[model samples]
Target: MVTKTSADVVIVGTGVVGVVIAEQMLDAGHSVLMIEAGPRVSRAEVVENWRNSPLGVKGDTSVAYPSRPWAPHPMGGEKPEDAYLQFSGPDAYDQTFIRYAGGSTWHWAGTSWRLTPEDMRINSLYGVGRDWAFDYETLEPYYVRTEHKLGICGPADRTQQWPQTGTRSAPYPMPALPFSPGEVKFTEVVKTLGYNNIPVAQARNSGMPYDGRPACCGNNNCVPVCPVAAKYDAETALHRLEKKGATLLVDSVVYKVETSAQNKIEAVHFYDQHKQSHRISGKLFVLACNGLENPKLLLMSTDDRNPNGIANSSDQVGRNMMDHPARSFTVTTKEPFWSGIGPVVNSGIMETSQGSFRSEHAGAYFRYNNFARNRFVTFAALKKGLVGKALDEEIRRMTACTADIVAAHEILADPNNRLTLSDKKDWLGLPKPSIHYDVGDYVRKCWEVYSQPIGKQIAEAMGATDIKISPKFNNSKHIMGGTIMGKDASNSVVDVDCRAHDHENLFIPGGGAMAAGACGNSTITMVALALKAGDAMVDQMRGA
Candidate 1:
């Protein structure tokens, strides 16, 4: 039997964007219901899972939260046919994310960065890639709200900010986290080359607590579940949303977005863990699913009126996929610049991400990974065929000497890098997501001509004895551009406020709606879009 329910506003995800929007709607005196495809587990349970896991898989982000059979997310090293996301192309879009209640933020690096004015208008200024429908000034206020909502801590000084734009309306909610010894050394060395290594604006507390959550205690475990509630993941806001009178339905895989004859979304249908169907109707529909899943569900819900898909009138529902393609340099330095002193990532070089050269090649930002190296170095030391004390000493020496610097490059929005429905089906008989990707000439040119040379110079400045640069590009998992936003309705899926062009009351926000991807973490921008969409939804409700 299919159960039916109703709410003033129905949300299809429980990630950071979803929860943020839900809270906004509830505050506006509207009834909201949020649906999550994955199961909900406590922080203690995830910590235990990570602790008891085999030493070999400790670093795997998905190891802490195993996916449900129905809501399968990709694992680290699965084969093509066995993987949840079927991938193909010159470059592998092997995006890593967990489909738990909190979504991928459960294991994210917690770096929160805002796009500069130049980033949003790349097409106009640089003649490459699509420009955002609106400018950064329109989105700046939302970014400030997002920072406060997530308790983002960053350097208060404008010079230390990521963009160095000197246009921020407000300071960070909390002061920045101090850099580790390795970061300080990297900053000093990079400065000699006329590059600035600035502190990253991250979604975690510092010094004292801001929200109900406590301040970060330097666990050095930002990913794979922060044991303490210091870090701001979507799961941390779940309880607060419930207390504000919003309904959260877990283990509910939303498979369909039902629409009326006029192309307005009326309800959404989902399948529960038992494969039982349920339908929830609402005046306004918000799809807060990720870049991949949002298009998958829309395409799956096609009817006679919408022969293409719910918001596929432009035939651009699943096109223009984008993410930061990264290359790294791992070197053994002369001195012991201990890196595992605080969060996994604390500082980055942001000035390099902006230049007139963007007209030809993409821009990139560099960061020295602050992850603890002991676990990464232990196995290599044992492989040397040494006994107890010798192996221990070797591990200590390598751990202290090793350093990793990564250059994450921005990519142009190529319509060919697309996501589509796969032939493979999950346990609930729903089609899996298949993405085809090529990092494209824009990013490759930047690496060969720009970022790589800078990386080599930085490595040499660090007094590296051994330098190894990655030969191929890897996905940063900051997915964007599937449901692209634009001014013209003929070629884009969503409008400036992320409202669907085909459906009046349907809004699809988050990473999927991003027009241009800067070389920074996109989560803050995604949440800002959610806040913008929430305002639109509130206005629509009032007009109704």
Candidate 2:
């Protein structure tokens, strides 16, 4: 077995959240080592991997992991699959980020949404879902810090979250994306309805330098890497940590996190590409491999100490699976605006987004900060710069276009839903994660209430002859709630600070620990929570 020098802190993943935490440690003068299971990749490869999926479509995972493109094939692929769970059942999917250096942010849409205040008090407000141990006010300051640090673009809607965020110190790093024709039409309808649509809050650089990444250049290849580096990447922060002298271990697959009898981490054991094994001890070990892998790693670390699984005191390591159930609707218009291609929309409805079954008669409710309004057809008009057939004829009409309003459904985890490890193991001899989650009945009710009306509004707004909701077959890219957090250890695996309630030295940051899913998108809130963790951990390290 090979041995490595020790680090003050050893981070198991180099995804956006892990990199963010590493940078925070470096900023605080702590030695850190970030280990990524995936091989190194460049920005061009990040975009090129998508190959030719079409311009305005969602992300394609065909070329994503050439190794284990599909799961049950053993996680012997790009990122460490042994670390993440792959579900197979009524709903089968491998909900994960990229295996390369940046994790999933390599292809994010760059849309950033602040979670609402009600998100924290799920138990109190919804009466059915669990409430966060801490409220939004505790996380408010971190939200502002993340905005400035990550360079967000938005109108700064503080009142919308009902006491979540406040006016910021610095404005957006770049100007908002120019409005297209669809946006104008949508805004008019929203105004006529006596509703105010807030400007979109996104992480894409409009045109200026924010944290050194270039501005958005209309590459339109966001699901892949941005050729111009317009979107935010955790690698940028990873490099900052490296520049500050932190160590990084790419292509290292850690198998188990060993522990001492005293309940402290003994050492982390891993292997390299050559099948060579090694071990490294740490004063503190953070498993920021993201939500799926965090608990998976914990379960794999069973040894002499606490063998019901590490911190299995509650046996809740990999329970409570939740995610945003997407329900999108399409509408065409007589008046065309820049389709949902470029960013920036005049208005979005965040009201009545987060509530309870008593209010919406669903398991829970979620609101979409719909960024794509009439904008949907703006680019459809471009038609790859061709004017012909149905698309061109529509564009040539010089009159209007189509619009799609996607309302994401929020599904709270039933005690039954979760990612449990399978008897089958990966290339590393570690058991692979088994996923078992599906949209429940109450969640469908929530979608019926939230999506049906939104579709009607779009059809009426655009004068569409008819509107149909995008088939339920189209699920979502947003995933949440595998390693859920809560006040009680019996109900949760981690706390708001993201420290695993089972292990003080271990923290799982990312979409995995969400106690409750947000009405809007979750990436921005994930970053904010990461920044919050960075600050919270420093004092803990100092023994404060």
TM-scores, each model vs. reference: 0.98, 0.85
Candidate 2's TM-score reads: 0.85
lDDT of 2 by residue, 195-292 (tens): 44445666777767678788776555554455677777676666677678778887777778887767877678777766677887876677777666
Model 1: weakest 10-residue lDDT segment is 1-10
Q: What is the lDDT of residue 67 in candidate 1?
A: 84
Give the clashing residue pairs of candidate 1, or none: none
Question: RMSD per prediction, one decimal?
Answer: 1.7, 4.8
The best candidate by TM-score is: 1
- Cα error, candidate 2, residue 212 (Å): 0.9
Q: For model 1, what is the alpha-carbon lDDT of residue 493?
A: 96
